[model samples]
Target: MSERKYQPTWDSIVTHPTPKWFRDAKFGIYTHWGPYSVPAWGENTTWYSYAMYREADENNNPAYHHHLREYGHPSEHGYTEFLPEFTGEKFDADEWAEIFAGSGAKFAGPCAIHHDGYALWDSKVNHRNSMNFGPGRNFVAEQEKAFRAKGLKFATTFHHAFNWFWFPVWNKEMDCGKPENQGPGKFYPKFHEEHAMPDKEYHEWWLGQTKEIIDQYAPDLIWFDFGVFSLMEKYRKEFMSYYYSKEAEWNKEVIVTFKEIAVGQMLGNKSTQFTFAPGTGIMDYEKGKLNNLTDNMWITDTTIDSRSGWGYVRESGYKSPERLIHNLVDRVSKNGSLLLNVGPRPDGSIPEEAQYCLNEMGKWLE
Candidate 1:
């Protein structure tokens, strides 16, 4: 492998340096879509699986009440039920590529696997994936080919690190995460208390999935979600080195992004800290922005639908194109890039509102 340049050490890994392509390409687009899109419910639709199983919180989560009214009950109609509904019948990979390219995005891709344990790729590691169940589509592979054909650098986002705590499997009464319900050996899912630290096997599967994504897709960028902060230092080091090693073979610079400074129970783990030391990779702000410009490369992932969730619902409160343009300009002015997110419907159609916004942005950019 052309002499692996990075060892699994922060000191060694930090030297791998941010790529100029990322710095110059000031805008990108990625998606938060999957079976969760089927329900098209919840304020934070991406977390519907988790919220559907819980009692109404202090804020009165709409997904919980919505589940009761629409889907019957989490005990009977769980997240798994949505898999069949996520047929993606209208999912046109080439059409999606055209829409993203029209948005003036430089890089684009899928969320791949969000906090939902369900994967969109044909996964050998997780049996409960898109190919075996759900829409029966290899979303990552489809998008990679189409996006690259459209002259867009492909990126994939992984939020599955928190899949360990995503579902309350310990409840016992719910069929959602029950051992038998998950099918044959329970499919490498974590069965732990919300606050518990996952065991060694779960951590191994986490790394295995990351490697699978790396080897299979060879994406230009990999943006990790906040769940990564909960990972142990060794897994973090290993994945970074493993991804960086691809630089020589791919003949293109690759980027791995980490969130800035997450400490304490932000990941719902109490009495311990899991902080990501920044400056090791590209810094990312999730639904946040910086007040001042900086020399180091940074990115902000904000949703295109201004109201509601990252995953699509029936109705979207799309940001006006002018607002999106200004936000992009502001981030670019501050030496950071904007990774705008779009939540396509379960049928794989980009919302007309989102399409108009992107079209307007594209025209303005032109």
Candidate 2:
């Protein structure tokens, strides 16, 4: 596919200190905590919602099936059942914040929403939210309060844009070529035709969801996942306006993250394009270190896992603490930040491997 084309018009008008907090902070944690993580079952839970619907062989090595048996099929022991298990009772926000601080993370926040369309905060538009359904707690709100109390800037990452297009990949209801006459559960429906105002509804609903997060939690940063390219120019402007207005009200700067492919358009001749431009980040290259950091500041988000999976699964092995410390130092020396990920279990507890890594990171930072 050809590269996406975007022309942004609002950078100087909506500027923030670029080489400030992000440059000095040096490290931040990207916590992929969600209802899916509750299962703590397989290597594929993070991608489970998408990988499950495809046949066992088709979805690039199906791990969801293994997840199903490990936890039970979604039909019998449905994913929803794990919600009650995510009591988050053992999750001390302050303690986590302290760990982040000790680990030298200048900021920390949870995945406010992922491709499954669930919100971590108290979202009025989406009933399937952490505050109402899963843990029955305002996870984002609580985290923000705790991080702020510890003097760390709060951030929120949203993966919902991918959910719209990505969710359909697994859901039989929306898959193309399915017969309309077929019964509901057997095959997917003609979602575009059946639903009235699908675009308007989803776009509005997504916007409303962001509004609620900004209003309630006041995130210092709002990171968007893939599919932002799909949003129309008008909607993008509207979204930027909303974000810039809110940032001004808070009298603080913010950083928005995007994948490397999407960064150029988002940052078009303007600061509002991204908190830290995409491609500005770095990662370890097998041959050697990634050289020539972008003229603009960037970040490299990596995991300790040597495997492809984001979370802990059987046989998952972590990189040596020495390697991770060196990687962090390499990025920092090149004027970049390392946004590390920690895949927590479903019950809101950090896995032992993750904790050990963070503890080691703390010692290195100290």
Candidate 3:
């Protein structure tokens, strides 16, 4: 193999091309399965746990009332308690991989860690992970093996970067601020009122988690949620540099997907906000689509049932299979990949409605 010419710097990394395999594949599958799936109750979004904790009105707030009635208050029975119910007893990694392969997806994986701070794999940095608390299994490793066995490229999504701010760290009513709360601080670190931004220690922990995922799984693709732009600049660059360097070491063309956050959204600092220059990697649009054909390749990550929620809901409405198929065709025509998402139940079973849609897409492909 020829020597890698690109360094870890943004200018050098920009020279690296998007892998041909990704551009040609045009479709992939990823799941949003996590501890949040246990409650399986949220509005249309995946921020149910946060909402349940923040909302005080049990009368109007369904998630809040549900949590209070079912799992007790957020102060006493925090989100960490959901870990026990997250036992993936019925989870079949091979079966999920087979479904993805049968659906004509070229790549498939799980969101290794969500903003909920629950790591799917056996994480060394955080004890509040699937292996230790919930499933007692390395879910990511199982999925990776299954994906590769079916000739599919493995990928992993990381939303942990946003966990620092996603939860109500300052809310004294929640377990986050209570020093007596045992696991809440580990999962939901107490925020310093003086410093609105994450401290150096938190940034290092974030980077370490990313590195741990990369070193352990060697995912072909790493997808980031929107809040990553708010992360520290040095940490962002360090992660990208380390990831790209690892790709070179393994002699593989790895891809990193990031969403562009608009100005004045989260941090209001454009200079500090992370934005990928053209050709750095892939650009992802969450629950969004483009109007015109883009010269640069991109991706659209929409859920099978956009109305219910991305995780799981007691009663959810789903988009029709025909609509999803049409969206897939339109995206492919515009040089974009469709990374369709499906939320599995807490028991680790893919909803029948999601399965129906995937099967329909497979038939359309055939």
Candidate 4:
């Protein structure tokens, strides 16, 4: 309704203020699912694509050797081969929303996109996504409507900022360099190759995908990954400015969560680190906690499978229900919210252990 209230500057943007909903909502849930879930392997299970293509001799790449034995060579069977396994056969969005609501989450949604570069929604900017390749369903859209129907705030997290260096685009021994892989399946940024340092075109596409989600979903929160540094100043400012502006038009109070990074590549000064100017948005901690409570609002996102990966792994060990309930209590005590992550099986079913923990937490909260 009004002209863009936020400008693309730290001073202009920080003044927009954090929304009240976030301060009050002490818990949320978001899922980590993709083609990587198909393998249901690897330590950091979501990193299967990246780790599977590296040399066996490289520092402790079990995925590389496992890939060689299970699927053969990466030259032939790249990540594209795993797409069929992600059928999402049992995926019921309404049920998922119910499960999240049952867990007492105030907000919930999909990770949207990860470092592997697959989009969960029906995306025009990125053709390699679940709607087109794997499940032929808009995962993001489904979660948005279902979660909202259950009276939970909708949110989306994007890790595509790290996608720029996710693949070894210059390596000829793998699919990351092939013409076929360049389209959407595995077309990563050419950062390792030559002079294309910042990769302006790729950066713009990053902005494009964010704009797509903001316009399509109008989420209550946007959680950014640590790769925020790679998006650089201009692109970062542009997207935030647009997101804050669109919030006004939608008449919604929204939140954006970003984390700190001490080092980043492709900088004019390579030593330049990326940290979000405080007061602009929520600061999220990854698998860690603040020593003491402070004035600012924050989020702590940790996996449900405490002894394993972020995405589904065959041998994941989960947290006890009491532990999870205590985790929620602790975060709320310290002026923070807990955003718990769950990795569903390839067939789109949340693991029984995770489901049990969630239900127990729901009962505890009730």
Single out the weakest 10-residue window by summed lDDT for candidate 2.
1-10
> Per-residue lDDT for 213-313 in model 1, tens only?
99998998998887776678888888888899888888889998867555566744453543445567888888778899788878888999877589997
Model 1 pairs in collision: none
Global fold similarity of model 1 (TM-score) = 0.94
Scored by lDDT, the top model is: 4
lDDT of 3 at 259: 84
After superposition on all CA atoms, what RMSD does each candidate show versus the true structure?
A: 2.3, 7.0, 2.8, 2.5
lDDT of candidate 3 over 1-366, digit per residue (tens): 124455556887776778888988899999989888877876643677777777767656677887778878788888877778887888999999988998889999998888877788888888778877777999999999999999999999888877777667667788866655434436666566634877787788788888998898898998888776656666776777778878667888788988866534554544533455556788888877889988999998988886748887768878898999898998999899999888988888898888888988898898
Q: Which portions of model 4 miss their true places by more than 4 Å?
A: 56-59, 184-196, 264-273
Q: How accurate locally, in lDDT, is each candidate?
A: 0.83, 0.63, 0.80, 0.85
* Candidate 3 local lDDT, residue 26: 91
- Candidate 4 structure quality by residue, lDDT tens digits, 17-86: 7788888889999999989998888778899998987786735898998888899998888888889999
74 Cα displacement, candidate 2 (Å): 4.6
Q: Put down candidate 2 lDDT per residue, 1-366, tens digits, no spaces.
A: 012111133443234345367657877886876666655444656676556544465356455566555655544444455567667777778877877777777888887888777677777777768766756788888889999999988988777765555433234342332354222332222254322233776677677888788888888766666556555545555555566556556776665665534445654643344322333222222213357565566566776665545654445777777888998889777766677777766666676777788889889788
Pairs of residues at least 3 apart in sequence or in different chains that clash in candidate 4: none
User: For every model shown, what is its TM-score relative to the native structure?
Assistant: 0.94, 0.79, 0.92, 0.94
> How many residue pairs clash in each candidate at the backbone level?
0, 12, 0, 0
